[model samples]
Target: MKPHIVMISPALANANNGNWQTASRWANFLRQRHAVTILPSNDPETWSSIDKPDLLVALHARRSAAAMEALRERYPDVPSIVVLTGTDLYRDIHVDTSAQLNLQHAGRLVVLQEAGLQELAPAWREKACVIHQSAPSLKPIGAACKSRMPRFEVCMIGHLRAEKDPATFMQAAALLTSPGIRLTHIGGALDAELAAMAEATAAAHSHYRWLGSLAHDDVLHHLRRCHLMVLTSRMEGGANVIIEALMCGVPVLASNISGNRGMLGEDYEGYFAVGDSAALAQAIARAAADSVFYKRLAEQCQARAFLFTPEREEAAVQQLVDNMLNSKSTNRNPFP
Candidate 1:
């Protein structure tokens, strides 16, 4: 019999959140060789189900702290792995009480980006590991996307929230009214104030559009059609969108935060300080107008994209699980 594992995350089954994607990916990847179940948070009693997992891998420590605590109490002997998301690292690790407790609760912690470690205390550092998010294999669009008009299209993908800084993209749109560049945001607004700002910013800039919550395929279609990608997020846990963009070979102009910098090299030329709309405008303008600059960004994106392939990610996940279960012995029953 396969060794059992339980996966917990704050995301609902149908939600499009990154954490949801992470959980689903892990479960699907590990299911072929392991007995895995996604732990639902609604019932603590469900924790007592038969075939107790050998390992518990929970994502979003800060947001799912209550669930984490309960599981820790319920399965004190089983190894519990906590996967930290962006809010947990850049935002909650500093301010959230439950997030702090999560660090102490888990036997192991996973951060999607390497730079996230710097923010943690030295004692907790030993328990954390960095795993880059994976991207789907490229379908390789046929038509070359040479822009026919002066209007350069850029897409930003993230749920609209304060930490995502959708407003920074909005602010840059206000400054990008030169008719040479167009900016469109793809995300559901989790913050009403940010939504209003996005609406107002779009209203003010004719070249800007806020597309609230696109279907995954539609978002990928938009990404393939656009000229460049931009992420003005205040914090991130290694955005899967960046990985998608890299695989799409779309150039990115992102905020100079650890998550974005970690993905795009330390010296990647396409960075602007967080909330720097004026600077972002300059980066957008460069990516839109200068072919040489655009080519450089595209080349780099392609180079890094190979690191995010499906096989590579599946193997990485499988290896981690294999190592986690390496010491455990499983039942050899032929029939039950």
Candidate 2:
């Protein structure tokens, strides 16, 4: 019989956030081989309706800490895995009590990027493994062949939140003197102040647009058409957007944070200092003007494309699950 797994996620499909996307994708990835059920939260009352899961995978250490602790108490024999997010690794684990406790509670810990493992303490190091997120590849739209108005489209795909650093993109947009440069920001207004700022920026600059809250399909569609992608996020567990861009043969200009660096690699030439609009503006200008530089970024990204394939990700997940399950079970059944 297939093992039943319950995934606890703080956000569901309606949330339309990164956590939800990860939860949703992982559910689809695992369902072919296992019985997977996803719940918004880990409340016992909510889980009472279903049969006890053989394994539990909780996303976000601090957000699901209580549920993890409760699960351990209720099912001592069952093993649990905790997946760390950007906030959990960069912020919460540093100071939050519950997040710290989660490090101790989990039988195994999954970190989305290689840099994430650096954030954990020495003792927890052995238990943690990096699992780079995957996105389905999309064929790049032939911009030269398209009859649409020829503008150098630069796109940023994340909500207007502090961590996402939308302000930097706005500043970069304002600094760009290139009339052909069109900046498109695609995400919902996660913060009211940021939303107002985006609106104000859009009004001041005709080239800058705040196309808020696009569906996943629409975002991928836009991604393929853009000449370049920008990820100014201050933090990321491992940006699925970055992978999507790489998979689509679209290169990225990202902030020089560990998460971005982890995804793009340390030697990637397209990095600017975190929150530095001037540097970002300069980088964008160089990318547009210098054909050699643009080609280099594209070539570098193409080389890393193999790392984010669906087959590789599925194999990693299956191997991790098989090991965890085998460790727990005396029968040592081979993975389905």
Q: Write model 1 residue lDDT over 1-336, tens digit each, in one string.
A: 888888877785567878888888888889999888887655566656635568888888677777767777776666667888777888887888888988886766778777888878887787777777887866644335445545577899998888888888888888774666778899998888998988888787788999999788899998877788999988888888999888886789999999888788787888899999999988888777678998888887777776677777788778666665653335221112
Which candidate tops lDDT? Answer: 2
**Model 2 error, position 315 (Å):** 0.7
Estimate TM-scores for all models.
Answer: 0.91, 0.95
Clashes counted in candidate 1 amount to 0
Choose the strongest candidate by TM-score.
Answer: 2
Report each candidate's C-alpha RMSD, comma-separated, in the order given.
4.2, 2.6
Per-residue lDDT tens digits for candidate 2, residues 155-201, read 99998899999999999998988668889999999899999999999
Give residue 110's error in model 1 in angstroms: 1.4
